[model samples]
Target: MVKRQAYQPILITDASRSQHDQLRSRQLRYIVMMSIRAACLVVGAILVGVKPPLLWLWLSLCGVGMVLIPWLAVLLANDGPPKEKYRLANRLHRSQRDETPPRSLPAEERPHPVIDAEQ
Candidate 1:
C-alpha cells in the first residue's frame, strides 16, 4: 500500500471566507462519514447474534458504508476550495513554457474558415 502525504495546505489566507469554510467543512465531512462507518462496524458486531434477521440489515448497511466511505472520504478530504479552481488550472506543473495570450484579430481581419470552406 502507498503511504499518503499531507501535501496540500489546509487554508489559504488570501482566499475568500467561503472558500475557507468550504475547506474546513469538507475535512469535517470526511471525519463524520468515517465515524459513521466505524459506528456501523461496531453496532453490526454487537447486533450480529442478539437479532439474527436484523443482522443482515446491519451487515448490508455496514457493507454499503464500508464501500462508499473510504472513497468519498478520500475525495472530500482531497478536494480543494473553489477559489483554487481557476488558479490550479494555470499551474498544471507544465514546463515553464510561454503561455502568452493569443493575438486578437478584429472581426473583419479574422479568418472566416466556416464561411470560406462552404464555398
Candidate 2:
C-alpha cells in the first residue's frame, strides 16, 4: 500500500499586506460597531420616552458589542498567509516545464473513478 502526501499550505509575504489588512479589518469593525451603537442609541432614545422594559438589556448588549469590536478586529487581522506558499508555487511552476517531467503515480495502480447510482 502507498501513502499519499499531504497538500502544502499557502504563503503570503507582501510587506504591506499585514499592515493594510489589519488596518482595513479594524476600520470595518469600527464602522460596524459605530453603526450598531447609533442604531441602539436611537432605539433607546425612542423607547426612553415610553419606558420600554427591555431597553436596559438591549442597551447593555450593544455596549458590550461596542467594547469587544477592537478585540475581534485584532483576532481577524492576525490570520494572514503562511510563509511557504510562494516558494512552493514557484517550485511547482518550474517543475512543470523543466526537462525532467513531473512525477507520476505508481505504475502498478489505477485510481478509482466515481460512479453515479442514478446512472
Most accurate candidate by lDDT: 1
* Candidate 2, backbone clash total: 1
Model 1: CA > 4 A from native? 1-15, 18-23, 83-119
Summarize candidate 2's per-residue lDDT along 22-119 as a digit string, tens digits: 67776676667567657756766666787767878876775676567556655655555444567457556755655532336442232222222222
TM-score of 1: 0.48
Global Cα RMSD, each model: 17.9, 13.9
In the range 8-83, model 1's lDDT, one tens digit per residue, is: 3233333344557877888799889899889877877777757877677778988888789888899888887454
Report the alpha-carbon TM-score of model 2 versus the true structure.
0.37
lDDT accuracy of residue 28 in candidate 2 = 78
What would the TM-scores of all predictions be?
0.48, 0.37
Model 2 residue 73 CA deviation in Å:
6.1
Top model number, TM-score:
1
lDDT of each: 0.63, 0.55
Pairs clashing within candidate 2: 11-85
